[model samples]
Target: MDEKENSTEVFFDILIKNEVVMETAPLDEQKEYILPDDDYDFHAYRILLLIRKCGIINEPFFSHFTIYGRGKFSFFDFLIRYPFYLKRVIEIEKKPKLLDNLKLRSFETERALSPMIKYIRGPWDHRYDGIFNYMVSKGLIKVEFTNFNKSKKAMCLTLTELGIQISEQIIKEEPIWVDRMDIINAIFPKNATNERIDDYIRKHFPSLMLGIEGE
Candidate 1:
């Protein structure tokens, strides 16, 4: 076996012989470990910034951009959110020109070591609903249902005056996030539907066919 494979097998054999214990705590007992920037206010601010920059995004689109990073959307999310990891991917894949091709700068890529949110679906701590509700309560954003594609109602979030003001202030304070948003625009084509993205992902990452989304 290869050295890496041999080492992995040895590690698993050791793990089988040992019991690992993980510490846990209840909601009330759990202490805050996330940095101040990862707090609710910052999440709210990011939602506002997204709305301001991307225009009115529908629920599905919002989830795709923010929370849904599984299956078809995985690589796109990896590029958009885990930008530092993107550089590593380029290096490992030996696509040195990708860095310049994507117009990623060191300052922008250094903003995150990994994605801030864990992408999952189907009943986890889905932060979008809670944060949207909190923003609604704070009068920072309004949630409205609109007719989409002439058939279905789509729930959309729009920034209120307060949200806009706060988002603008955040933009002024930290413009690096604007570069991050630019990465999103660069990675995904304008008005590209999920089907197109799915097709592209399937073509590029054929292994994902085994674990199809929503299955």
Candidate 2:
């Protein structure tokens, strides 16, 4: 393994061993057992910390950029909800046949393009694994598996306290991206169903709904 992978593995070993003991230990002992500063890949560490604070939950879809935006316009939300999709659109633009193959037409606005592109792309991107794995290894987030039956399983991601704290600090220091709130909010409104989200996107961002039936 490379340095970062090796370091992260060592960190996970320490974290898993200490998790139970730390829960029952004295406050000072708990603090002492926390991941050491020197052991972290600082860039990845900071990214996860920032993401947590921004209220963008990392849902671990097939793509690295598939995080959900919740509660407001934060940098993490912008990264996942906008720039990531924009990059995908750019890729599509470079190859018009891609849109044609998917039975989609390019839209002039992001509102129209975002959802359709995401649907067509199907969230398979794995570029964010480095940061994700680092966060997992450091115990800032966890991976859980649910076995539904003899042949099915589902994986879920949830944050830990340390992850929340770091993300909060990132928010406190960075300026909010106010303009993108409507789009972000539409993508993940409070308790909305997939059907509702689809309806809302189609109604408000018509460009995204183009070439799809039942609009």
Candidate 3:
């Protein structure tokens, strides 16, 4: 983390950059992101979208997200939204494939760290752990592992080109504030669960995967 880039204020500025990009997007794509009375896609549309919009460029992206790191609140949520808004986001995935066990990384034990610090607070935990094992299983993400180490080892991660493309195409449509409102309305509506939130989300955001009603 760069000293000048990790502060909370820097984080908001990072968001401001995307917000600027968002302003350049076609107005037609800026429909209100209301939720449905029912289902949604929290992964493809949401996760990918967060990364695209929130580009993995700086530490600010996680400045706010680390707050929810103790829980599985999906930091990827705020990062991926507008695929067209970010150019560099698609660039990060251009690295070589991660040959599982081929590379390694070691994290210093931080008993002083909070629970949020241990986990990335997003879906990367599994990817980092199994070397995209499950992703390889699904054929969504692939990797080969070589060389093993146990005592005080280093764990290196290699993200593939497909991973970058996947990140771009899987982004969600809802912005942070919008999605939050949609979720709040869904889980805690004026009358406790309004169907309009569901209807609106479905109409404008047909690609979402996570259900908010029970959340």
Candidate 4:
């Protein structure tokens, strides 16, 4: 099959996997699309892959006010939750061909199941805190502080040596994810202000910026 057909088939597989549509029934027979909650191992693996590839300075923020500032926290959710959005961002920024490396296909299979993936938004998934806490308990990551301003230190999440070693192993197992995180990192480089990320999200995904209650 051609690439488009292959991508379509992959998307259908995702829908079935997520129970968005009945696997045994026709594709038209839809089910309530309840978002799937990722398991600890799944979240752990992706988080490791993210930190491994992006490194400390470019890590996704745990919160906007803490790392970035207002609306910037969504970048974390964007990378972790929205694969197709990441793909589109890379395409729009004229980065390297995405499918060329198939860097995010694993993520695409899980989160990019539909073309409307970009429009899907909700409350920040609280599962992240649990995942980070678990990783911390295992000594995979540490909380460090960087100079946010003259007086304040910004909290930075960084991988430990063990984290780095395991992350490398993850890379060896799935090299396709090599530079996928870097594409987003390059767009929001070290010391980039919250406004920069906030503005970008507002421009591209205004709907997402709105509160879940539509504030």
Give the number of the best model, judged by TM-score: 4
Pick out the ten consecutive residues of candidate 1 with the lowest summed lDDT: 63-72
Q: Say what the RMSD of model 1 is.
A: 13.2
Tens-digit lDDT string for candidate 3 (1-215): 77766797687898887775533557787666633211123332333333233322223322111111111122223222222211122223332231121121132121211111122222222322342354444444323232112321111122235545665454343333334333322332222111343443344333332432221
lDDT of 1: 0.54
How would you encode candidate 1's per-residue C-alpha lDDT over 38-139 as one tens digit per residue? 466766766676556544344543432222222223344344455665565456557565566455666765574333343322111245567778889998
lDDT string, candidate 4, 104-199, tens digits = 556465644212222223224456668778888988876555654554454456677787788879888865455555566676664565567666
Q: What TM-score goes with each of the models? A: 0.51, 0.36, 0.22, 0.59
Best by lDDT: 4
Residue 45 lDDT, candidate 1, scale 0-100: 67
TM-score of 3: 0.22
- lDDT by residue for model 2 (1-215), tens: 89999999999899888874543767666654434223346445444543343233323332121123221112223234344343344353364433322322234324421221323212212224554577788877654463322443434334667766665565555433222222333335422333444444455433444354442
Evaluated against the true structure, the overall lDDT of model 3 is 0.30
Minimal lDDT window, size 10, model 4:
113-122
